[model samples]
Every structure is written in C-alpha cells, then in structure tokens.
Target: MIIEPRIQNPASLLPDAVKAINLLYKAAHSAGVPDSTLELVHLRASQINGCSACVDAGARGARKAGETEERLYAVAVWRETPYFTEAERAALALAEAATRLADRADAVSDDVWAEAARHFDEKELAAIVLWVATTNFFNRINAATRQPAPQTWG
Candidate 1:
C-alpha cells in the first residue's frame, strides 16, 4: 500500500485538481446527463477505485434520488442483477472501461464505444467521458487524502 505521509504543506497538485474538476463539472452539466445516471456512474467508478468516501457519498446521492437499497448494493454486481436497463448497462460499461484503464490495453474498444453510442449522442457521450474522468480524479484524491465522506451528497 502506498502510504502518503501527511505533509505540512498542501501538494502543489491541488490547484490542478480543482481546475480539472471545474472543467468536468461544466461539461457534465452541459451534457445533460440525467441526475440518476450521473450518480450511478459515480458510484460505479468509486466502487472500481475502492474509494470508500466516494462510495458513501454516491450511495447517499442515489438514495436521496429514490434508488432502492437492493439496487444500490447490487450495483457492484450489476451484470448479475436485473435492476438495470439497457441504457444503464451501457453507462456502466463506460464507467468500467474508464476506471480499469490498464486492463483495456487496447483502450476503449469498438464494442464498448458502440454500446455507449447506442445509448448516448455526441453531447451525452462527452458527458459520459467527463463523468468517468472526473470521478476517477475525485476517487484518487479522496483515497490518497483519506478524506471522510459527508453525511449527504444529495
């Protein structure tokens, strides 16, 4: 495990993180992804990254948006569950591909892209990509910083 010791000074990387987050937030809002799907993608990415804070926040967001506990728990094993729609499946695939970047040595494959394309237009696709990227950034920061989650991310 990489144990980053607490430093007296904030890392020089903080500003860059904020910039990327701001850009992604703008893109996500402009892309018009439904709030539910956004929360789902965030949760899925957090799960993949093993970021507990993100998981907690995303789960609360899902619950506040009326998602069932069963479905929330099942998200980690989504393929084995029947709670998701085709669109949701596609988005999940995108999230997985984005999070496990090393595994997809060939990069985003035609099949995955096609699946996402079927469910999302260009603008929506942009949103989906931004969502995956942004969530990954947040996961890394929160995991590395050992930040605790707030009671609500709604």
Candidate 2:
C-alpha cells in the first residue's frame, strides 16, 4: 500500500513559515539543552502523536548526532530502559506530560514539572518545552495531511 502526502509541505504555502520556524528552531537550539536530548524529546512527542514523518526524521537526526542505536530503539519504551540519564528522563517526563495535555486534568502535573526543573535550568526547560510544542505542531499537521515519511531525509 502507498500513502501519498496531501501536500509536499504545508509550510511552503506560507512564504515565511519555513524561515520563521527555522529561526525558532535556532533559538531552541541556543538554549543549552543537549541536541540529542532535544531530538529525543522531539521523537517522543512525534511517537505519541503517530507522526511517522517526524518520527523517521527524528530518529535519523538523533542517529546522525551520534545517538546510540540501543537508546533510539528504546525511546518508545523509555521508562522500562536504563539507557537514558536522569536529565534525559526528566526531560522525557516533561515532554510526555506536555504532549498528552488532554489525557489528564492537570496536563503537566507538579511532580513532572518539579522533576524536569530538578535537572534543567529555566532556559533549558523553556527550550525543551518549546521543542515539544514545536514537534507537536508539526506532528498535528503531518498527521492531518497523512504526510508520507521520506525514504531519505536531510
């Protein structure tokens, strides 16, 4: 079976969307969170949202940045694995909490926020949150358009 994308890229419709997103991405990257960790956060949110496009790109991004295969394979089942560091775990928790906002009344509970705060400073946490939000934004769009995952991506 084949699933074609509804469009090549939604951002292309808005002339400035890609540039604006790229600039936002640069700001997120500047905030002090490890690149791998941000990739992990992005992957996790995309996974939850069932955005195969982002998932494929995120895994590739993580791997290209030297993320271990063992860790990448375990991202979907991270809680059961010991591959992640405490900081990564905290970031993941925050990502999950933030992503699944409708699953619970509190959305991001205090415990989850506290755990993330324990590991990241204000700037880093802000970046992680931004990354998660950014990932979700893309995920929702891709899922809506049924965007096909790329065979080879940059």
Candidate 3:
C-alpha cells in the first residue's frame, strides 16, 4: 500500500503539524502521565483508530516497559476487564475522548475530565490530553504514510 502525504517529514512545508507535535509532546510529559500509561493510551487509541503501525509501536513499547501481555490485550476491553487499575481506566477514557474529538467540540467532557482529575492533578491532566493528542497525531502520520508494523520492536 502506498502511504500518501508524509506529514512530519515535510514539516518545512508543514510547519504547523511539526510545531503542534513538539508542543504537544512537551505538554504530555509535563502533565505527569507516566510512561507506561502514556504507552497504554497510545496503543488503545491506535486500536480504536485502526492504525496498525501505531498499535505495533505502542504494543512493543509497552512490552519493553514491562507491561504485562494480559494488560496489553485487555486494553481494548478495559472497562470489562480486571487487568487495569482505576487510573488506567481514566486514562483510557481520556484517550477515547481525544480520539473522537470531532464528534463533540468538547471531546473531553466535564464528567470525564472530572473523573480523570480525581485521579490526576492539573499537570497530569495536561499530560493525559497531550498523550492522547500525540498518539492520535502519530496514528495519523503512520496511517497516512502506510508505515508497516515492524516484525519486532526490539
């Protein structure tokens, strides 16, 4: 399959996308979202978006970070599973909200935001949003680029 327009690589011609990614990444780390959670969010969002490349990268990253295969497999059905903690559920909700941003102007509704805030502070909330947005961005890039999942992430 031919991946059409490479968004980040031609950033000189698409500065906005690049800048947005840079700022978003910085904000995500600042928001206090842990690396493991961030990776989970990315993987889950990729799953939802059907972005194979992002899913591959996220799953591999999670595994490398010592995330259990049980949890990784349970991510899609997190609401029904016992593998994840309440904190992980909250982040997943935030991820869904961000991934479906176009559906509602305020994709992250007050209730969802509040639920997330109960588990995380302002910085963490920012990180959650950033993580969500960043993963979505990567999904878009990989989807557009037709980037394939590597045989192995190591």
Q: Clash number for every model? A: 0, 0, 3
Off by over 4 Å in 2: 152-154
Write the residue-wise lDDT of candidate 2 on 1-154 in tens digits. 5688887678988878999899779989999999999999999999999999899999999998789999999999999999999999999999999999999999999999999999999999999999999999999989998897886636
lDDT of 1 at 110: 85
**What is the Cα-based lDDT of residue 45 in candidate 3?**
93
Off by over 4 Å in 1: 1-23, 150-154
* Candidate 3 to native Cα RMSD, angstroms: 3.5
Estimate, for each residue in 1-154, the C-alpha lDDT of model 1 and write its tens digit.
Answer: 3444344212344667566667777779677777778889999999999887789989988898788899899999999999998988899988998889899586678898999899889999889888888889878877767665554437
lDDT sort, best first = 2, 1, 3
Alpha-carbon TM-score of each model against the true structure: 0.82, 0.96, 0.80
lDDT at position 14, candidate 3: 80
Q: Of 1 and 2, which scores higher on TM-score?
A: 2
Candidate 1 local Cα displacement, residue 68, angstroms: 1.6
For 39-143, candidate 3 gives per-residue lDDT tens digits of 899999999888987898899889987899899889899999988878888889988988988889888899888888899988788787778877887777677
| Candidate 3, position 93, lDDT | 91
Each prediction's RMSD over C-alphas, in Å, is 4.0, 1.8, 3.5
Clashing pairs in 3: 31-123, 31-124, 31-127
